[model samples]
Target: MLYVPFAILVAALLFGVPIAFSLTLAGAFGLWITLGDVGQVVEVVGTTVFSSVADYTLSTVPLFILMAFLASQSGVARELFAALSSWTSNIRGGLAVATVGATGMFGALSGASTAAAAVMSQVAVPNMRSHGYADEVAAGAVAVGATTAILIPPSIALVIYGLMTETSLGDLLIAGILPGVLLAVLLAATILIWVRINPTLAPETYPSSWSERVASLRGVWPSATLILLMLSLLYSGIATPTEVGAIGAVSAMALGFALRRLTWQGVMIAVHQTLRASAMIFLIFIAAKIFGYYLSLSQIPQMLVTWVGHLAVNRWFIIVGIIAGYFVLSMFMDELPLMVITLPLTFPIIVSLGFDPVWFGVLTMMMIAMGLVFPPVGMVAFVVSASGGVALSKVYKGTLFLILSIFAATALLMVFPEIALYLPALVRGREF
Candidate 1:
């Protein structure tokens, strides 16, 4: 059954089928072959599809996606970049540094790497170009900065990981905060270092007047308020992560309306985008559930776990092996699809080794973060380059520094797990 499904999925993907369709077709084929009855396959497919998407926890996806779309459409992205640039414009490379900082904040609200890249590229790239900053430097900053979305709180990847792993969403969300912030700081520092060494790459801009700087804060307050509301609700246990997402959507729409920026067309577009994205995600999720069920029935997870446990190698070596596998897989796959396919295989192994699943989720997300800026297939890089009308090579060059920064941060987290664990522990009163 497993072999059949894998073959079908691969064949369909190779033929350029959409991922969701390929997954569903593959699962249907697997069920048909295993049951030896077409009727039974139909029944299993129908039942699994219904049960998989009937999850209440999944409601957060569309709501958060909608909120992000609305915020991006309402001119909030430009406001955020402007505010950060005003504060960080004076020093050499400060504009690039501020782009990373702004991207981090934008990532918190949006949680979509492409959206972050598009937003920042539109706002920051032009300004950097006008300032005589190198095209590659500006494009690269936007590309790498956009990837911050993957590790930040409200991340769609984290939410999906929590749902799939059956880990606490709040715990995973909280776990992301520290690592995400640390990565941002490190990336900013990297930009500063590079600018100091090669000042020609990034020209200095005059700092805005204090009054201008202070006034720019008004445009950014909506995003800040939204973040505060989200964090407070989740931290205080006042709402589940799903509820927080729904509240965020409603709040964002309200803000757009109050700002007189929420046109009927914008609302329609947001709803349409949300629906399309939600449908695609749910379909993949349902298909993955059937695939996972088939794998369990075959005892693949247990067999792999038993095999790993039987090995006499050091546990840290095994952990490193698993992380390395994820890093490689991420280069070829989008984070969501990769997680959906591989988490079942890896989760049992990690748990069998006495590792915390929540911590591992954070680590896994960081690995995905690195993949988002990697060359050729990096989705964020593609988005940034296309948005800025810059070459992919330029984007890759700029991301080199940010990638090193992410690796440094990844090493810190790996050496001291507490960076990812501490906040969740303080909030939840137990290690997850």
Candidate 2:
């Protein structure tokens, strides 16, 4: 009976049905079959709707979505890129490294990967080209940098993970901090290495005036201040996730208006974007709750955990296998649906191993980030290619070495779980 719904889900996904509808229908069928009662399905629907609304933590989802959309209207990406480039232009491969930093900075506000990739591709690639950067190096850096957008705070993907796995929203948000910073630094190092290997890949930078660098910083402080404000409030337990999200949203809108970057039309566009994104996430949430209920009733999570526990291999091998599975699945599917499908199964096995759920959340997010930019299904690579007017081949070729940065960060997190957990622990300890 469990296999029936699972099969239907795969088929629906293959046939191009939206994930929410597929999950809902498949879950409804599974429930109807299991108890020989359709009434239970009705009951599940009613309860799911009520429970979803009543869950205050989940309210953070749309508020953050609104904040991201509103933040995008502020036109911060170009300012961020300019500031980073001006500050770093004196070093070899500095512009390339700056692109990585800028993407992370903008992503801290917008929380949208494709938007980040596109904006940076358009803004940074031409500047790199004129600066004599190899097309491969320039395009690859922007594309790879864009992939990290979701790993930063205020990330939609992290929020989705929190919702699905029932992890504390604040813990998940704070946990991503160190790993995100680590990945950014690794990206900078990767750029330096590539430039050193072939000096022709990037041109030398002229010295930047200190005045120009200081002036450029003006573009970033508003967005940066909002991020710090939210994190501080959440970390200190002065506000709940919902309250922080609302605060972030209002701050972003105010910032946009103050900068004159957001006009009436921009406001409308942000609202429109918020509605679409929020609706999609909401639909998926409802479907997942029902689908999760089916999985619980079927005992699949426990059964799979018990089976994996009996394997003769070392537990870490199973863990490696699980991460590897995410890598492969991520190549073929978008992160959200892929997570919705696999987390229920793998999440249990992770808990069974006595691993911290917050650490696993960060691990899963990193894998998903790699999947977003890795060949041949790297979604951000495609966006960068299209926006930069470069061939997909060149984009991937340039991005190849940087992919190792993500892998290295993941390995470090595995060896030192504190990379993902320290902030969460301190914050939770202080708050709780």
Candidate 3:
């Protein structure tokens, strides 16, 4: 019976209905089929959507979005890349290495992969190409490395996951630190190795003097300060995610004003973009509530978890299956709405298996990050191609090895849960 509604949801999605409307219509049908009253469906959806979207914690979404947009318009991306490049441009493939580093650093502040990809594409790709790097490697590095945004602190993906699962947002955000850094290093190593093997990939190098390296630090302090502040607030339990985001937003605006980068027009543009992104996320939040309500009524979620608990298979296989399932679903769908609709089903099953929610949150964040580079519907890849004016085929081709790197990082996480748990546990002083 639950399959009926799930099918309708998929069909609605396939037929080009918006995700919010698709979830709403499908959940309404599910409620009608199960409860036999249209009014009851309306009641559940109206009440749940209202209550859930009104959450104070969820307010972090727009604040972070605003912070990122303002930071973007304020020249943070360009400055950070220039700073990193000045320090690294001399060695073979050094500019590409700087691209990975800059993308990772910028992604931390923005916490949105698409924005990071587009910005890096504009900032890094052209520079790499002029330095004689191949299109696939340049575009691919931006596409894959931008995924770090989805795992770093203040990530929109982690925010949605935390809100839906009733997990501690602070713990989830902090848990992402080690895994994010590990992926960045893996990506930087990949560039070094690939460029070494196929030296043609990067022909020109611009090495800098030690004095220039010291001067380059001038461009990095805004990002450095914001990262430190956000992490300190969250890790020390001094501010909730929303407060941290508020402070970040205010600081970004102040920096823009100080640096003379925020024109009145830029502020307007940033606010407008923030509203657009926030509206999309909030709509999905409301629809997820409606869908989640229907799932709860069906008893199917509980049954699914119970069935998984009773399975004779190995527990680790279940974990792999969930991660792999996300990878497959990502190829056909947008990540946020897909995650919203599915967490109700997967969360319980994962909890019943006795995994730490915070650790699972990190794994889930990694899987979501992987989706940004997955083929077919890889949004980050598309953004890179468009922004860099490169062929889509070349971008996808480039993402292949980077995606392998993502998988390798995922394997590390699975083999060592402590990698994600250690920082959060140490911060909170709890044994995992």
List per-prediction Cα lDDT, in the order shown.
0.85, 0.85, 0.88
Candidate 1: segments with Cα more than 4 A from true spot: none
The stretch of ten residues in a row with the least summed lDDT in candidate 2 is 423-432
User: Quick one: best lDDT, which candidate?
Assistant: 3
**Tens-place lDDT digits, model 3, residues 350-374:** 9988888888888887787777777
lDDT for 292 (candidate 1): 77
Which ten-residue region of model 1 has the weakest summed lDDT? 26-35
In model 3, which range of ten residues has the least summed lDDT?
329-338
Which lDDT value does model 2 have at 98? 92
By lDDT, the better pick of 2 and 3 is 3
lDDT of 1 by residue, 238-260 (tens): 89999999999999889999988
Candidate 1, residue 152: the lDDT equals: 84
Q: How many clashing residue pairs appear in each of the predictions shown? A: 0, 0, 1
Question: What's the lDDT for residue 354 in model 2?
Answer: 85
lDDT of 3: 0.88
Model 1 TM: 0.96
